[model samples]
Target: MEIKLVPVRPEDKGTLINLYQLYEHDFSRFTNRDIDKNGRYEVNIDFYWEGDERWNPFYIEVSGTIAGFLVVLFENMDIDPDPTHVIYDFMILQKYRRTGIGRAAAIKAFKMYNADWAVTQMENNTPAISFWRNVIKSFKEDNFTERYRPERKKYIQELSTKT
Candidate 1:
């Protein structure tokens, strides 16, 4: 399946509300949030509509259908003098997962930004750990840095195109 990363337009908001709820449900497993009686989860996305220049939202498309969405943000965590690309959120529909589309999309995303990369995944998500490990390894080999931040209970990885 071919994956296309299309910039999510304002008209796509309603669809994203549902899709994002799906993502929230899956993510709730790693956090304290619980699925409501209706089997739905609520995550405030008001900021996404604020039209922030620092944030980007994209719909993951497969064969003209919306497979999922990815939210990328330019954030200055001030780890250094330069701002960095942060993959704030990424979710591929359950049906489209485990295929090569995700890996391809991630590689494409990194190349599109191409400065510095900082990615975090909940430590409880072993599959995410595996996915990030594979992508970073293929993109940076042993040149990348990864550490398990005990305070956040998340795996943090840093990479640079220069490396």
Candidate 2:
């Protein structure tokens, strides 16, 4: 299947918002998040299209169908810079998980920006940790480092894009 990362535009906010709700729903099991009176989870995706050059938002398309979403952040974008990128959020819809679509989308996202990368997962999210470990290993061999940040309760996987 052809996997494509279609940039999310301002007009496409609603689509991204809808997809984001599903993404958050998946996290409900691993988080203490509760729906509010609006019956919707709070989503903070407006920054992507708010003219922040550091944020990249895209819809992951598989065989011409919307399968997921990815948000990449240029690390330290507002500060003294370094060659780094961060996979802020990545999710493949429930129906597309384990179908290789997620892997394809991940690799594509990695290749999109020419810089070192950082991917983090919540400490309790073992599945995400495993998925990212496998994907990063496949893409970078043994060149990446995985470390746990106790204060943040997350595992961070860092790798260089340079060959």
Candidate 3:
């Protein structure tokens, strides 16, 4: 399975919507809330409008099909620091799980952006936690931090590495 990163275009709205719905459904399993409510599901659309100046989105293609997507948000501290990229969301279709597509996509994103990237996984998703653990292990240079928020019963794992 050859994976490639394709820049997200306006014409890809349908595919992005489909992926967003799938991501929302998957997220609901851990949050126990319908994220589609209040049209929050349109966040991706908004991100697209916001343009690549700050956030950039990519479609992960495998065997010519869009198997997943990833969004990178660029940030800088104060006015003198170099910019860093964060993986705001990454989702691979259930059928494609464990196929190495996700890892390839992540590596591609890291190389394409050539900056630090971070991902946060909720504590409830043990599978995701383990998945990220392995990712960090394989990368071996990223720093991982765990933070707990009692109000939301959410645990966040932040991982980052310099390119």
Best by lDDT: 2
lDDT of 2 by residue, 47-150 (tens): 77777888888999988899999998887778847747999989899899998888889999898777889999999999999999999999889999999999
User: In candidate 3, where is summed lDDT lowest over 10 consecutive residues?
Assistant: 35-44
Estimate the lDDT of model 1.
Answer: 0.82
Write down the TM-score of every candidate.
0.89, 0.95, 0.79
Over 1-163, each residue of candidate 3 has an lDDT whose tens digit, in order, gives: 7899888877877878878888887878886765555655444466565544666778899989989898887765335266767777889999899999888787777667545556666767888777766776576555666677777665565555554
Off by over 4 Å in 1: 37-39, 77-81
After superposition, candidate 2 runs with Cα above 4 Å error: none
- The candidate, 1 or 3, that scores higher on lDDT is 1
Tens-place lDDT digits, model 1, residues 1-163:
6778998777777888888888887887877798778877866676776856667888889889988888887886435456788888989888888887788788778887757888899999988889989988997889889999999899988888643
Lowest lDDT sum, 10 consecutive residues, model 2, at: 75-84
Clashes of each: 0, 0, 0
Clashing pairs in 1: none
Q: Which order, best to worst by TM-score?
A: 2, 1, 3
TM-score of 1: 0.89
